[model samples]
Target: MSHLSPRLMRAMDVAAHAHRDHRRKGNRVPYISHLFGVMYLASRVTDDEDVLIACLLHDTLEDVPQEYSEGRMREEFGDRVTGIVLGVTKDDSLRDWRTRNEAYLRHLAHEAGDESVLVSCADKLHNLKSILADHEVLGDGLWSRFNAGKEQQQWWYAAVHKVTSRRLPQIGLNGEFGELVRVLQRL
Candidate 1:
């Protein structure tokens, strides 16, 4: 935080406020904590300010209402950041879980680029980490938070790992995505 640039610092503020009332499913922790994990993991993959900012605000589009959509994100951040947030956001209109997950994967495969995948890579990593950690304690009860069950959740993670790993074969970082893939594959 003390080392972050002004642009990224502002993003942190926006994410904290936007998710002020949201809590994590696993332990009911503040949602901003998850965003922070994603931001930190994304930072490991790249120092690009846009990706880091997007990571912090990635859930904003998915969790916040239309009035607080990317338009506000654009005003607070910029088009680049707004676009990155939008890129990672799934269309909630698709009520069916599998359909929404599949469509999101397809969208990432076709439309999302390396930067988008970078944010996604960190996102998946942190999410998988939470799922595993909570599952260790809460066991199967943790799956209740997600629409997809254990098998389906595993499938999505594996699929996203394949696409994102192929898109970003070599991040030259500490292998966060690779570690995530390995960990998720073992599950």
Candidate 2:
């Protein structure tokens, strides 16, 4: 088991503050919940302090760069944490939704290392659970909350699963992720 340190707590605080105004897409739930969910899921797999911290802050660089720049992350959390977060962040410069997502998928297949893959798997796993729950309530309406509709979303999740499976086959989380993907597809 990995012991939680002051830095881990600090990461939670920073992520909370940075995402304070943000909400889950098309919902009232605070965005920090997703960050915490990712961190909690990752914690079940490894005790690495940096990976946990990276999980907490993974979206900051992509979603709220103004609040938490790479420089700030490096200064506060150090290089490995910053690198893992960067590895998972989508290329917002692409503008087109499909283009950005494909870039991310390519990164996962080619460039992302174990730590990045671990954080991404946890993040996607949490999102899949939320999507499944929300789908029960909203049914087809839930697809409106996302940039891509059902088909594109399915493709993205499956692609992420493929990369994670190849990248971290030993990690049990990949199995859960794949199961969730299958569930989502059947919905």
What is the TM-score of each predicted model, taking all chains together? Answer: 0.90, 0.97
| Tens-place lDDT digits, model 1, residues 1-187 | 3378888888889889888888897467998999999988777657788889999989888888552676778887888887887888899999898999899999888898667888887888788888888878887787788767878888888888888877787864326556765665676
lDDT of 1: 0.81
Please report how far candidate 1 places residue 12 from its true position, in Å.
0.7
Task: Please write out the lDDT profile of model 2 over residues 69-170, one tens digit for every residue.
Answer: 999999999999999999999998899999998999899889988899999999999999999999989999999999899999999899999999999999
lDDT (Cα atoms) of all candidates against the true structure = 0.81, 0.93
Total backbone collisions, model 2 = 0
For candidate 1, report its TM-score: 0.90
Off by over 4 Å in 2: none
